[model samples]
Target: MLNMKVGESVNEYFARTLAIVNKLRANKGKIDDVAVIEKILRSMTSKFDYVVHSIEESNDLDALTIDELQSNLLVHEQLMKTHVVEEQALKVTLGESSGERGRGRGGMRG
Candidate 1:
């Protein structure tokens, strides 16, 4: 069982988990889809908690395949990336605005 890291990307986490699952299968061990799905939900980072909750509340997890869950997560991952980029851009704009004000006051004092 792989534990998800706080800063780990979804792609990395999924790859690690999939590797483990593949190893188990190669060894002829029987794995339940429900158990794997539940493990994934439980192991996800806090950032994904909302997505997990939404999935659990709106869909039948038992009926959802691993591929389906991964696809949903991929969508959220893209959203997260976009949100982060937007936030960084906003911060840069705000920083520049504040910087201009500071420089203007400094020039007047000189």
Candidate 2:
């Protein structure tokens, strides 16, 4: 099983894992759907822990298909992207405010 990388997005990790699983299947290896589902859940980054927990609590892992899991993860991925954009905007706003203050202070000293 491919290990999920730090800061790796869900789509990337899912694609990698699915590739591995497909290779194993092609080689005539038997795969357990539940195990794959659990592995995906466990391999997720910490940021996805809450969503994973909610899924585990609300749904049966054995019954959930890979497509279903992917759909749910995609939702969270979008949310994460939105949050990152908001944070970047906030940082830029704060930086501009600080820059204005520094320029004003320089003017006062001159």
Q: Each candidate: what lDDT?
A: 0.88, 0.88
Per-residue lDDT of model 2, residues 4-56, tens digit only? 89888888998899898999888978898888899899988888899999999
Once superposed on the true structure, which residue ranges of model 1 sit more than 4 Å away at CA? Answer: 97-110
| Model 2: worst 10 consecutive residues (lDDT sum) | 101-110
Name the top TM-score candidate. 1
Tell how far residue 81 is off in model 1, in angstroms: 1.4
Candidate 2 off by > 4 Å: 94-105
